[model samples]
Target: MAQLRQWATTLGFSQIGVADVDLSSAEPGLMAWLARGFHGEMRYMASHGLKRARPAELVPGTVRVITARMDYLPASVAAEGWQAVEWARLQRPDAAAVSMYARGRDYHKVLRARLQKLADQLAALIGPLGYRVFTDSAPVLEVELASRSGVGWRGKHTLLLSREAGSTFFLGEIYVDVPLPLTEPVTAHCGACRSCMDMCPTQAIVGERQVDARRCISYLTIEHDGPIPAELRPLMGNRIYGCDDCQLACPWNKFAQRARVPDFDVRPALNDPTLLQLWRWDEATFLRLTEGSPIRRIGHARWQRNIAVAMGNALAAWRDRVLTADEASLRAQMVQALQAWLAAPTVTGEAQAQVAEHVHWALAQQHAPQ
Candidate 1:
């Protein structure tokens, strides 16, 4: 076990633990969450069914699961005042606030390659081991396995949290047929804190350790591939990619670790971009700029759609208060860009409909009473 830990550390995993394959205890909560339809448009979650809870079934003969955590705070964010920096970005009504995790190379590719290497290392040591590696894969209950393997306790926000690393990390797993000793689980530390729930821009955290994805800004902007609910667009603020309000509000994040692997470093293209700047990217430019980044997975249309909603929110904020000379200049520039795009004939069909509708909503906010 100690040697395996050493190998994982060398592979850039912050921590690794072995968990017994028995996840029957978690099936009830999984079923209940699905029954309540909290997963929203993430049909993949429901499509997997109970197979998510049955690790051994998913990988026949697997008696143990290896859980790994990789810290993802970019090197650019100062460790001492990172939360303040993120909060300030959120306060900027025109900034396109991306979740810290997706600001760099796609973690799915990074973690999977490293995990497969780790599995190969194990097989070399033990001689002919059956194993499968998974990173953010839909058929696995990653959080449940991670928590049970002592990676961290589950926070009220349903994210795995650690005293040493907090919730700003990515999770991956390896199911092995070998019977490794199980690591003990950690105890919960969220005694009486509800800051995450209170600070969620759309109140997506419906209950303790429960999140309703339908109202989650992350889900609405990223996963739901149709029109964003008209009522929820304003609450989304300027978060153009994924939302991090819950993690930002958690006190444990003071301990969040920076990435050991440079692949998780924040890209210059994503760091503190303005809504107007990102909104101007055409489909080809969007694809070119976000080439290796996870943001590319959402594609150009969803990218524009998210920016349009954010621009609308920024427009509303500008209209709601008195502005300085600089603020007024920015507001005017944003309005002009939005209007020019509205008049352009290049965009059409569903993509055009979503962007145009959001643009009109933003324009309407200019004339509405504060």
Candidate 2:
């Protein structure tokens, strides 16, 4: 385990743990969450069924799972109280506030490659090892495994939280045939704290440790690939990529660690960009700018749809307030951008469906009350 820890540190992993394969206890909660439709449009969550909880079923020879944590808070973020900078960005109606996680290279690729290498290392140490690596790509119960393996306890926001690392990290797993010593599980620390729920603009944290994805700004902007719900649009504010209100509001994040690897560093394009700046990127530019970034997966249409919602929110934010000369100029720019898109019925030729209604809603917001 000590050798594995040293190897993990060299591979840019923050922490490591080993969990037993008997996750039968978590199956009930998984079914309950799915029954309540909490998974939203993430159909794959239901498709895999009990295979998610049964590591032995997912990989026949698996006896124990190796859980890994990789901190993603970019180094460029202010070392002290970076959450304040994000909150300030949220207040700026025109800034395109992307989730800190997606600001850099896609985590899926980074974690998967390293996990495979780690698995290979283990095989070298113990001949003919059977194992499979997975991150968010599979239906494996990541948070459950991590928590069980002492990676961290699951917070009220449904994210793994650690006294040492906070919630600003990504999780990966390697199911192995080797029966390694189990790591000690950590106790939950979220006693009498509802800051994440209160901070949720759309009230998506419906219950203790349960989130309704339909109402979540992060889910709406990223996972759901349709028109923005009218009521939730304004609440989304300027978060055009993914939302971070829940994580930002958590007190433990003050201890959020910076990424040790350059792969998680923030891209220059995403460093405090305005909605207008991102809105100006057409399909080609969008693809170019987000080449290796996770934002590219949303495609140009969904990207347009999300920004349009933020732009409408920006317009509504100042609908009742007086504007300075510069503010008026910015307002005109926003109005003109919305109008230009409205002029063309097809927002994007490649869009599966046009976001015309969203633009209309955005223009209509010009007359809405504060």
TM-score of each: 0.98, 0.97
- Model 2's alpha-carbon lDDT is 0.90
**Which sections of candidate 2 miss by over 4 Å?**
345-353
RMSD of each: 1.2, 1.4
Worst-scoring 10-residue span by lDDT in model 2: 345-354
Stretches of model 1 off by over 4 angstroms after superposition: none
Q: Write the per-residue lDDT of candidate 2 for residues 285-336, one digit (tens) a residue.
A: 9999999999999988899999888999899887889988877888899999
Looking at candidate 2, what is the lDDT of residue 290?
A: 98
Taking the tens digit of each residue's C-alpha lDDT, what string does model 1 give over 122-234? 99988999999999875998889999999999999899999999899999999999998999998999999999989999999999999999999888878989889988988
Candidates' lDDT values, in order?
0.89, 0.90
